[model samples]
Target: MTTSMTKHALVVRGGWTGHQPVETTDSFLPFLKEHGYDVRVEDETTVYTETEYMADVAVVVQTNTMNTIAGDELSGLVAAVANGTGLAGWHGGIADSYRNSSEYLQLIGGQFATHPAKAPRDELPDDGTDCFVRHTIDIVPERADHPIVAGISDFELTTEQYWVLSDAYNDVLATTTIAARDFDPWHRPITCPAIWTRQWGDGRIFVSTPGHDLGVLNDKNVRTIIERGILWASR
Candidate 1:
């Protein structure tokens, strides 16, 4: 039961199942509980429309991908954050979600443009794992002292390296490079934000592009970064 001493967290997760929204979100319930949050778990965004509950929520941990959000739902979410509700999410769950909603993109500060896969002998990977290229997630030297990534060092992960379309508004904490393979259309290497945070009104927004699956989420650095990100985003 929620009490005055407990912080409310609304976990809205649903959309493309391929992202493993349920399994992934489920992995963090214990962390949130340990942090004193009385979590309300749902697979819908309508919870955002419940003004009273929205008001009580200190943070929203979302994991919906490619789903459309209604105007009222989006508005309520925006209003709650503007009034000091934090938001945090990872990978397509946050970045690739609500592609039709420009307002949502503006809020997130970036969108998933593509993930270049390893060049094939003849053609590209017709199956899914091609995009799982080995890459290093480099921590930004200047921002290493930031609380979320404070003792973390640069690490490598064999997973999707997001080539994100990002704006300058985000305070990027970490980055990863997209290899400029000969077969790839992009000529030069590109660096994309692997982790970042944004200040929205009185609220905080946290994002990490590394959570491609359970394996990635369970990685020491990735898992630690996410746990810290959630705490840092909370009001």
Candidate 2:
């Protein structure tokens, strides 16, 4: 079938509302609709294992964080996506969930390593303030031509910049430097990859490290990056 044909998408959202999980999922619904996907929203993670789950679905969008699923169920998901399904998620939903499951990490290609919960660098003051943080994103020419990020221009954010442990299999798409400051000590500077895509068998996967809050998505640059990722990863 052609990529333009109607496709099915499953959206599983809701976990540790600190991430504003539901709102993020809600905001992304229209994007899917605009791209010709028949979307299904699940409030819990169990729907992934229903006997009649849409194995033929073109894409699975996960907005869940800090949740665990049984080994069998997680394996079922890995198998489905490996055999030609597509999986896409952003921020903690994809990288922070299933912290204890090694298999889950193998499929997703990364894990949330750490974040400055209370760091000395007050640039991102923890004083209950709301604003966007600006940083420069470096795009890898290797994936600059990929459909997901083709038209996306480098941008900045005012949210928690995620530090991830990514596998070598990942196709690094973009990155932002995490320089050392008073709150962070470093003799040299370091850079973190902010977005990436990977392949598993006939399946495809995409992940972005931004989107810590609804306000974070308010930036048009961040919104467009995620919107394109969903369409690019969908089978």
Candidate 3:
């Protein structure tokens, strides 16, 4: 592939080791470079405080989970994206982060609520894998034409199936149904957003709910969706 080097991609990954932030994000470095991005990686979110640097970045691919972002740093990040810088990430890294910051949640347009296991008595695993039942990711029939998910058929995954809190503003491309088991508290099966995109101000945001570890990130469909999402979200 020829490098146009037309964009800058910033990978900000850290906060939780269970997610293997560094390893997971590193897997995509070659892809980004092949697709014309000059990638810069940071293990911390402090770069969010670099106003000019953040603004110049074409996209910020973040993977920090359950971490706190200082007010000023968060402000710079939000400001840059609002003015046209892109933001894209997967799983808890994007949705379950900065638990105390409602503004940050508002920016992503989604939040991880829970990932129910097989039995009600089953303790939740931080990794979110279903112990007994495999989860299915269904493409929204109406969204089969979206660039990020086009041609991708519905698929099943044994990994964590996320049940998230999201808004109607999101353009959801894929979803997974959390079946209500006899042992579960929720009587009705909950359908949650698995992959989606949001347009914030002049910037674009993309989120995929499947990434819990390297294996899931390496899945053909999951990887393709993430790659397309990143490119689509880039400035």
Which candidate number would show the highest lDDT if scored against the true structure? Answer: 1
Identify the runs in model 2 with alpha carbons over 4 angstroms from their true place: 1-6, 117-125, 129-133
* lDDT (0 to 1) per candidate: 0.90, 0.78, 0.88
Number of the top-ranking candidate, with TM-score as the measure = 1
lDDT of 3 by residue, 162-186 (tens): 8999999999999999998887778
Local error of candidate 3 at residue 19 (angstroms): 0.7
lDDT of 3 at 164: 95
Q: Give the TM-score (vs. native) of candidate 2.
A: 0.88
Q: What is the lDDT of residue 199 in candidate 3?
A: 91
What lDDT tens digits, residue by residue, belong to model 1 across residues 83-202? Answer: 888999999999998988899898989899988877754666667787888999999999999999999999999888899999999999999989888777778999999899998888
Residue 228 alpha-carbon offset, candidate 3, angstroms: 0.2
Per-candidate TM-scores read 0.96, 0.88, 0.93
Q: What is the lDDT of candidate 2?
A: 0.78
